[model samples]
Target: MAMQGLLPFLAMVIVQLGYTGMNTTSKLAMDYSNMKPLVLVAYRQIFATFVMIPFAYFLERKTRPKITMSVLFQIFLCSVTGITGNQVLFFVGLQKSSLTIATALTNILPAVTFLLAVISRQESVGIKRITGQAKVIGTLLCVGGAMFLTFYNGPIINIGESKIHWKYASNSGDHSSHHQSNSVLGSLIVIASTISWAVWYIIQAKVSDQFPAPYTSTLLMCFMGSIQCAVIGVCVNHHKSDWSLNSPIRLVASLYAGIVCTALAVFLTSWTIQRKGALYVSIFSPLLLILVAIVGWAILHEKIYVGTIVGSVLIVMGLYAVLWGKDKETKMKTEGISVVMPLEMVEGSKDLELQLPKDSGSNKELIANVEENGTIKSNEDEEKNLGLS
Candidate 1:
C-alpha cells in the first residue's frame, strides 16, 4: 500500500533523473563534440519512437481505444509542442548557456503550468482561498528565484572543488561579449521552451482524459515528433556531415535522451498525470535543478554561486508551498465527503423509518390479542417485538 502511494513520486524522481542525465551528457556532447542541437533533437525523436513502438503495439493492443481524429490531432500538437519545440530549444539553449542556468530556468515550469491550467479552467483559482493564495505565492516565488538566478550572479560561494576535473573544464575561458550574448539568447530560447512545455501539459491533460493509454499516446506522439523533427533538421542543416553520430559522447547522449528521457520519461509522466494530474507532475520539476546542480558541480567542475544557493532555496520553498496547498485541498475534499456520507446514511435511515407501515392488519390484531390477554404490550414494545409493526 505504501509502495503504491509512493509510485507516482518515485516515477517523477526517475523522470527527473533521466532529464538530469540528458542535460549533463547532452551539454558535454554539444560543448566538446560540437554536435548541432537540431541533429540531437531529431535523433532523440527517432530513437524514442523506435523504442516505444513495440511496447505500444504489444502491451496496449488489447486495451487501446480506437484513435479518433480529435485524439490524433491532439497527439500531433503534443508532438509539436512537447517533443519538437521543447527539446530542440532546450538543447540549443543548453549548448549556448551554462547547465546551471538551464536547470534553474526549468524551475519555472510549475508556475507556467499552473497559470496555463487556470486559464484553461482545468485548474481552479480562488484568490480568497488559502490553497489558491498558496499557489499564487508559490508561482511568484518560483519566477522570482528563476529571474534572480538568471540575472544576478553574486559572489561565488567557496565550496570545495571537485577532484575529478573534466577535460573541458580548462577550455571554458571564453567569457567574451559574444559568449554573453549567446547565453542571454539561450536563456530566452529556454524560456520560450518552457511556455511551449506548459501548453503541452494542458493539451496532454485533455488528451489523457479522452484517451488514457499512456504508452500508446507516447508512441504516437514520438512517431509524429520524429517525422517533424527530421523535416526540421533537414531544412536547418542541408549538409549530411552535420548529422554524423561518429562521436561516442554524441551517440551516448542521443541514446540516453531518446530511450530514458523521451521514451520512458514521457510514458511515466503521462501515467502519473492520469493518476495525479498535470500539476502534480509539474511540481516535481524543481528536483531537476538540485540534481543538476550537484551533478554539474561534481562531474562538470561547475562553480556554485551564492545566488544559486539563495535562489534554489526560494524555489524549493515555493515548491513546498504549492504541494502543501494541493494536499490541503485534497484533504478538505476527502473530509467533506466523509462527513457528508454518515449524515446521508442517517437521513436515509430516518426516511425508511417514516415510510414503514405502522402496523399491518394481522400484526395489529395479534398485538391487540396479546394486550387483551393481560400481556403488558405498549406501542414501542409491539413495534420492537414485531418487525412489521
Candidate 2:
C-alpha cells in the first residue's frame, strides 16, 4: 500500500495501543504499587497538570483569558467529573474486575452520552425510521454486551487461547478464568465512571462557551482535579504509608497517565476535533477493543471466550448502527427533506445572497451551479418564468 493510505491505519494502531497501554499500565501500577485509588487519582491529575501548565503558558500566553469565576467553576466541575471521578472509579473498577469487562463496559459510553443528551433536550430524535430503530437497538446491544460480560459466567471456550496458545491450559493453576469474577462489580463501577465522563463532556461543551483556549481550559481542570483528589486521598488513606509516592510503578503510572494519556491524548484529540470534527474522531475509537483484547491476552493473560467474541461483535455492530443512523439523518437534512432549510434556501429567501457592493463597481453577472433532475445546471443557463400575470 502507498504510504499516504497507510497513515490512517498507523494512526489507528497508535490510538488503540495507547488505550490498551493505558489500561494495562494502570492495572500493573495498581497491583504492584498497592496504592490507594484516590491517591493515584491525585497523582494522575498532578502529573497532567504539571505537564500541561508549562505548555499552556508558552503556547497560549498571548491568548490566555483573564481568570474569571465562571471559568474556574467550569474547570472545577470538569476536574471533579472527568479527571477525579473517571480515573478513580476506573482504577477501582479495574482492580476489582477483569480488564476485558472494564474495556467493554466503556464501549457503551457514546450511546449513553447520546441518549442522555437526547433526554436532556440537547439532542433530538426526529426520525422514527428503520435506521433510527437500528441505532437504538444497536445501542441496547452494546449495553447488553457489557451486562453479559459482568453477569454471565458459564463454560466458555477460551477463544484467544484456542487461536493463539493451544498448549498452555492452566494459568498459574487458576481455571475459572472466563474473566476475573470481580468483573461483575467492576463493570458497575466503570459504568458509573462512563456516565460521569459523559456528563463531563456535556459540561465541557458548556465550558467551551466561556473559554476559547482548549489547552488552558484542560490545564485548569488538571490543576483543580489534582488539588481535589489530593485532599480526598489524604483523608481517605490517613496514617497509611502505602499512600506515599515511594512505589516506582505508581510514580511511573501517574506520570504516564498524566503526561501522556491525559495531556497528550487530550491535546491530540482536541486537535483532531478542531480539524475534522468530533464525530469523525469518535466513530473510529471503538476499534480499540481489538487492541484491548490483544493486550489482555498478551500482557495480562486474561482468557478471551465465546461470550467476549459475541459481545464484542454486538457492541461494534451497535456503534456502526448509530453512526449509520446519524449519517442517514444528515443526508436527509442535506437533501432538504427535513424541516430545517438548507443554507442556500435560507440565503436566497432572505435576499442576502449576491448583494451588490456600495463601491459603485461594475456589476458582474453571477451564476450558481445547482443539481436538478440528475443534471448540473448554472442558474444563468436556466430559463426564467417571465410571463406577466
RMSD each, Å: 17.3, 12.3
In model 1, the runs with Cα more than 4 Å from the true position are 1-16, 168-181, 262-285, 334-389
Best by lDDT: 1
Tens digits of per-residue lDDT for model 1, 51-148 = 77777788779978899999999989888887788778877777777787777776566667778877876566657778779878988887788777
Clash totals in order: 0, 0
> Compared with the true structure, what per-residue lDDT tens digits does model 2 show for residues 1-389?
58755554455356556656766666766655556678877877777778777767896699767879987887788788877887678778877776666776776765676677667754555456665576588678878877776677567664544233322212311322433656677779988887887676567655654565556776777788789888888888876685666766667767766666655454444343334333455566566677766766765666776777777677777766666665454444223111111111100000110111111112133333322233343312211100000
TM-scores of all models? 0.76, 0.76
Per-residue error for 260 in candidate 2, Å, reads 2.3
- Compute the lDDT for candidate 1: 0.64
